[model samples]
Each structure stands twice: as C-alpha cells, then as structure tokens.
Target: MSNNGDVFVIGGVEHMGHVGMMHGVDPNPHMSLYAAKASGMMGLTAEMLGKMHGITREAQDAFGVRSHRLAHQATVEGNFKDEIIPMQGYDENGFLKMYDFDETIRPETTLESLAALKPAFNPKG
Candidate 1:
C-alpha cells in the first residue's frame, strides 16, 4: 500500500480496460515485504504513524474539525466553483439532480463530533 510505483491503464471498449501496476500484493507471505509490517488499509497505517509520532486523539480530532471548517468556508466563498464540474446524480429519494458542491463536505463537523467517532482500524485504541 505504501509502494512508490506507477500504474498504466490500457484502453479497451467503454469501461473495459486492463490496469498494469509495477507493485501490488503478493500471495506468498515469505515473499511479501510490507504485508506483515503494514496494513492494507491507509487509515490503519495513518493511525500507526500517528501513534508512533505521539499524536493524541484530541489533536487529530481538532485537525479534522479545522479541515472541515476550511473546506466549508471555501465552498461558501465559491472558491471551488471553477474546479468542480456539476454532475447529475440521484438523491436519497431517487430524484435526479445536478450536484455542484461536494456532498461529502460536512460543514457542521466539530471537535466534539469527531471525538465521538471510534477508531476505525483498532477499536480498543
């Protein structure tokens, strides 16, 4: 997951393409280098690195809150207007609508809300 490699996609019929990668997972444990030391999930790796660097949960939550605040502010200021392309997607009620803004951006996210989230990779942590 932490390999510095390049991926090439060979084109074919619509949506059908072959992806070639310089690095990937190996089935054999004895031949694998990072399989035992690192997790396949990036979140788990990030958590491990954070713990190694002495980054506390409170600090992480505060950072997440700050990031959400900045993203929300940028969206309100129309900073992403030129960057985002409006796409047609279905709503929760199956109504089709054009989405211009990032739907995943949670403007209401706060440190309290983030702190309430359990560790996704290691629950005990």
Candidate 2:
C-alpha cells in the first residue's frame, strides 16, 4: 500500500477526526484541504485542539465509552481470528496441538461497570 501520488488529511471542528491517503480510498480529496482551512490543526495537542474547537471533555468521555464498547465486541468476538495461526502446546513431554482464538473476553461488559470505570484517557492531566 505504498503510494507516492499525494496525501490528504481531514479533520473537523467537532471531536470527530479522520485521516487517509489521497490516492488510496479517498475519492474527493479536495474536501480535506478545505477542512484544514478552518481546523487550524497543522499540529496541535489533543487538549489544545479540543479547546480550539470547543470540544467538551464530557462529550469526549461519552464518545470514549462508545468506542470502548465497539472495541470490546470486536476483540471478544475474534473478529479477526482467522488471522491467528494454530500453535502447539505441551503438557508434560509430548506435543499437543491447539488453536487459540481470543483470550481477552470477560462476561462483564455491563453499562453499570462502564459507568463506574474511570476515564481511560488523558490520565496525566
């Protein structure tokens, strides 16, 4: 996926942000150039960018929870399990062949727990 044609990046005044190569998947690349005019984010810290765009911390936290849920599902369901290779496990001395899927699933993804959990980002500040 190496291309030397051009590069296009896009961001919004809102919390939403996205970036992609111009020659790759983006059909209308000029829109990214247009968006950069108002974003003023040639390079900016997350907090700084948020402040510049009036992105509230509460709103960011809400979006973080939603992203966590989506990631939890994909990880637990082994959405990309087919990419895993079958490995061998040994008991005592003999070789035991086994296939491992996902080992990160907990049966506890309730909303109550999610609410109780602290913010998972920007912990230093």
For TM-score, the strongest prediction is: 1
Model 1 spans > 4 angstroms off: 1-39
lDDT of each structure?
0.72, 0.52
Q: Number of clashing residue pairs in every model?
A: 0, 0
Candidate 2 lDDT by residue in tens digits, 10-46 = 4445332465322233345485575553343333346
Worst 10 residues of 2 by lDDT: 20-29
Pick by lDDT: which candidate is best? 1
